[model samples]
Target: MPFYSSDSDDHRTPPVKMFGRQRPLHAVFGGGRVADVLLWRNKNLSAAILIGAALIWFLFEVVEYTFLTLLCHISITTMLVVFIWSNGAELFNWSHPKIPEIILSQSAFQEVATTFHVKLNQFLLILYDIACGKDLTLFLLAIASLWILSVIGTYFSSLNLLYFGFVGIAILPVLYERYENHVDYLASKGNRDMKKLYKKFDSKVLNKIPRGPVKEKKFK
Candidate 1:
């Protein structure tokens, strides 16, 4: 009788799988929108590639100019100093540098350094994106017009126009590619996290909600 009762209970109702096709809440809020924007912004591969190429060429051209060259050096130094100071202060008790060092060793410092590296790489990616295509073209045209006028200036007379142009032609593409790759990596990681979060919530709360066939929207 017990075995028969157990059999009847088993046939009473099949267990419902608590995983549904509910959209991720975060995805609905802004994750998908942000992803769309990121993709849209990066869609014109040709334009981005060309801009990167041009900037590289221009950078090479300007590398030899004493003022521009000095500016690059100064900019790099300033960025490094800012990164170290900001991150170091946050990571360690920079108010007492020696005390923090004694307590945490250089390992804490190294962690801060790593954070700076990540941030700097991200900044470079942004800069590379901005420096190309519309931005680079306008900038170059303006600089060229100025350089033509400056040709008569004795101090600016030593500029190597041909060499600078050649360098820009050579370098920008490679730098742009690096930035593109980094951006892609970041995007993928973000998407993956969003998917994971969506799945977690969907399996729990969302499954309990009645679901219907999802209608797709077509947007031009």
Candidate 2:
């Protein structure tokens, strides 16, 4: 009478959680091998990549051709788009929209300008809110990230760096989801170690310091 299967086959234990989520397809990574080490999350991988990128930026004289090379790539992309549009127009018997006309259209320009203006205003408001201490740590970190990016941007093309960042953003969360348990274990271990270090420092260093003059029972 039960709707569900009563056989032992239907009640087998589920696969282990990867990262922090239930097993995703990629989590079937042939356990306990080099593939696990290479594909799964590793803390040192980040540091290694950053050092490598910096070395390549300098060794290849990336600064000299960064913008020039970017322009060449953009030129090629523009040609490909134009080619596709021209062919599509002929095949579909559609009128070719003149680029100059589109650029000069008052309504089109106004709509584009309005959208940009609204977005810029919203961004500025969020920045002002952060400056007012909505989240000082987040604001400071964002500024630091921008400063580092500007320095790196001088030596590397912006598009390549931007694309890398976008790819990391899109991919890292899926990876973490797929290996959730492993990631959480590493994080908890790090937290415990840091807490022990801080406690040791507090006891051995902070406790040795005499109370400063400001704390010496401030006489009225």
Candidate 3:
């Protein structure tokens, strides 16, 4: 009979995490202090906290009423507006007022126009390149995703997007860890299918297309 000792294999610690990457809830959204208790000890509690916080944030974003916003601290601008309105706008009105003409000057409009034109041209050029690129499949996929998001926009508040994304991140890691083998098997199957489809298309459809002439390199 052979006996194995505890000292046979030395224990190794987890990799060093930066910006509190070791933290539970903070690490999900951003890096912060390591919440050892919540992270390693009680992950379920951490998940609950994350879910509850996301829900609270969503409610805060959707309910932006003036007085209600103050207690929630939804938006400082909203609170200020409410304060001004409640105090009466006439309080700031002076007998002599000298509003600057340059505030609405055509020069400002010209600057804005120039900026818009430059940015619009850049956007168009990028779009054109994407359309002409080999990554057209991904470009079309992105467009489809945008269309789906537009449809989703009609039914849900934008805040729900952030809320759901945060919750998903918090819950997904644990789920993936528990079902890694299953995920890997499914992923491998999908990869094999895609490769086969690509090969078929290359052989049957792509082979029928005429090839473009290769350009000769110009010597400097």
Best by lDDT: 2
lDDT of 2 by residue, 73-127 (tens): 7799988888888889989997774665434567656655765576588679877
Residue 46 miss distance in model 2 (angstroms): 23
How high is each candidate's TM-score?
Answer: 0.18, 0.35, 0.44
- Candidate 2, 52: how far from true, in Å? 24
Each candidate's lDDT (Cα)?
0.50, 0.57, 0.56
Report how far residue 117 has shifted in candidate 2, in Å: 16
Clashing pairs in 1: 51-133, 56-168, 56-172, 57-168, 57-169, 58-168, 61-164
Ranked by TM-score, the better of candidates 1 and 3 is: 3
Q: Sort by lDDT, best first.
A: 2, 3, 1
Mind giving the per-residue lDDT tens digits that candidate 1 earns over 123-215? 687556655655543345456776876764544333345444544544443343346445444444444455566678778977889889899
Off by over 4 Å in 1: 1-178, 210-220
Estimate, for each residue in 186-212, the C-alpha lDDT of model 3 and write its tens digit. 554444455567679778998989999
What C-alpha lDDT does candidate 3 achieve relative to the native structure?
Answer: 0.56
lDDT value, residue 178 of candidate 1: 42
